[model samples]
Target chain A: MTDLSQQLAFVLEIDKLKAVYRQTTVKEDKDRHENSAEHSWHIALTAQILKDYAEYPIDIERVVQMLLIHDIIEIDAGDLFAFAEQQDHAQQALKEAQAAERLFGLLPPQQHEQYKALWFEFEAAESNDARFAKAMDRILPLVQNMNNNGGSWAKHKISQPQVLARNKHLEYIAPKLWQYVVQQTDLAVSNGWLKKD
Target chain B: MTDLSQQLAFVLEIDKLKAVYRQTTVKEDKDRHENSAEHSWHIALTAQILKDYAEYPIDIERVVQMLLIHDIIEIDAGDLFAFAEQQDHAQQALKEAQAAERLFGLLPPQQHEQYKALWFEFEAAESNDARFAKAMDRILPLVQNMNNNGGSWAKHKISQPQVLARNKHLEYIAPKLWQYVVQQTDLAVSNGWLKKD
Candidate 1:
């Protein structure tokens, strides 16, 4: 096959993956469920909006790439709830890391390096870009649930303190965004969107 | 509950949604099946990496913002497979608009407007930033599949021509990125990672 055709086939394969994402559902929206593609698109935009408030100058492009590939491992390991019991956390990371290696390996050598690096950086949350990206990753969902009146949390019976402890990292990464999250959380509690601890 | 607690609860609700996203799957690699939070990060990074090649001058900040919020509606609309046979393409858009209204509404009224506008710009895909962002959105999946050796395509039996056609839009928006995609596709086809037409 010619190069153009090969690329076309590659894209077609990715489209099939979209089906996997579509089949998965979130309880947050009664009529809606998030898909993998849409998830990637939303977070990239979140990074853009929150870039200025980052603790330091970051290469916005790197942050976006990090967000885009950060979760691909879920394809193999399945997604672990951030607040799920800790017994499986270590095993989940190992499974996910192996999955990341295999998946990223599909790209040509150079491109694979590029993507893998970004994924690692985002996971580490060490760089300014990664930190900012991590902050947005933490922030977008808060906005979604608040607007939905704690659609998923209420459904799942998650406690307020549990939620706060899980995402407290946001406070250090993007304080302004963290502030916004704090304010929204307060509103949710008073409105009965969340159970008081 | 106090406003502060409510706000935290609200933000935590979004976090739950993110957890829901983390659990979702896409047929692609775990890296590519990335949750919404990570997806946003990748696109912002893509913008930065390819910013120099944008057809027009782009406000990187605005472009980044557009990338992040572009998919929040997927929180409601779910992801629509670009290549799927849809009876009504506009149906997803309508659902997304509704989702946006509720999701962005969580912010202070003034902040809500700020984010909504960014989302609108991304949806329009008219400005340089939007176009660049849109280009990144298209290209990332292609890259993911290419890296994965067309894993999802072969599984789904998506046609090569269809893949090319769906993604051709990127050519008009970001020529260099488009060219790179073509190169990768060529490699995929030659390696038998994808079937020839």
Candidate 2:
């Protein structure tokens, strides 16, 4: 009813994120898929660790915030596989926007708007911070796939071209990580971890 | 190794954190225990959401950074149960310091020092940022226990005095949240969720 109640409610509600599993598996626990909560944590840390590689000066804090809250929508909308063959971007966007409204609405009014805006900025990937945050989002799982012998990339029979195309925006956002991703993709192909196109 | 290699190595290595489970369970998924990675994420977000409640002017970014990398040592040192009747904090400090060296060392030399320093700062919990971050860490699991019908508290036969004693530092760092915890503990005791000492 009050602000603290709303804050606690929001905090408790987001715990559901820990249950929303992604296709990618953890390095040590290959049998278990990484959940949205941990995925958010890893990428927020990744954004900070890789801040120097960003193409533009960015607010590392804002980037971390975006990365942290970006997947709260998945608490309700559910994780859509990044490598899925057919993605209804419009439909997914609508679902996530609705999820954002409900999830962020659980916070106090100011934070509700602030977090909702950050989530939108992350979805749009327009600002330097948002772009860098999005880059961290894509990059972590790419390497996680490498860690688990191709992980979901191999599971879904994904090709190198698809991986490159999905992550092509990295070239502009983070040229250094783009180079790293390209090199890793080459290694994955040679090692038969990622299928050749 | 080049800085890039070291950075990527750090990124890949911390994925092991996802496998390090904590004593708390997720609200929706009571059957599963929360892992260190997600716990880090939740507390970092919690620090941001509750920044206004801090006793002093704190850098939310530093708080988030501290929370994000704090548990990373669990990748090597393993999680020490907060409710354990007898804690060898001295041994934990030694093990975690060593773990910090190996884990943070995976990064470039600069981050290795930066993260290691932040980890130590968090462990000390003396600074404004560190205290707030530490508060979030304690409060999250406290409420998770309440959410899941006195989760680890019931399982470990923990008591009111134990919970209050464990989180007593919140009184100085975050008065509002400390009050909230006191109230919640009273309710938890009345509801028979938590046992009386």
True contacts kept of 2: 0.88
Candidate 2 residue-wise lDDT at A132: 83
Candidate 1 lDDT score at position A134: 75
- A22, model 1: CA deviation in Å? 10
Please provide, for model 1 over B101-138, each residue's C-alpha lDDT reduced to its tens digit, 9 standing for 90 to 100: 88877765665688888888888877777878887777
lDDT of each: 0.64, 0.87
Per-prediction TM-score, please?
A: 0.57, 0.96
**Taking the tens digit of each residue's C-alpha lDDT, what string does model 1 give over A6-105?**
3334333433333334322454444355655556655665565456666667888677767766666776776666567787888998897787787766
Number of the top lDDT candidate: 2
Q: RMSD to native for every prediction?
A: 8.0, 1.4
Among incorrect, acceptable, medium and high, the docking class of model 1 is: incorrect
DockQ of each: 0.18, 0.88
- By TM-score, the best candidate is 2
Candidate 2 stretches greater than 4 Å from native: A85-87
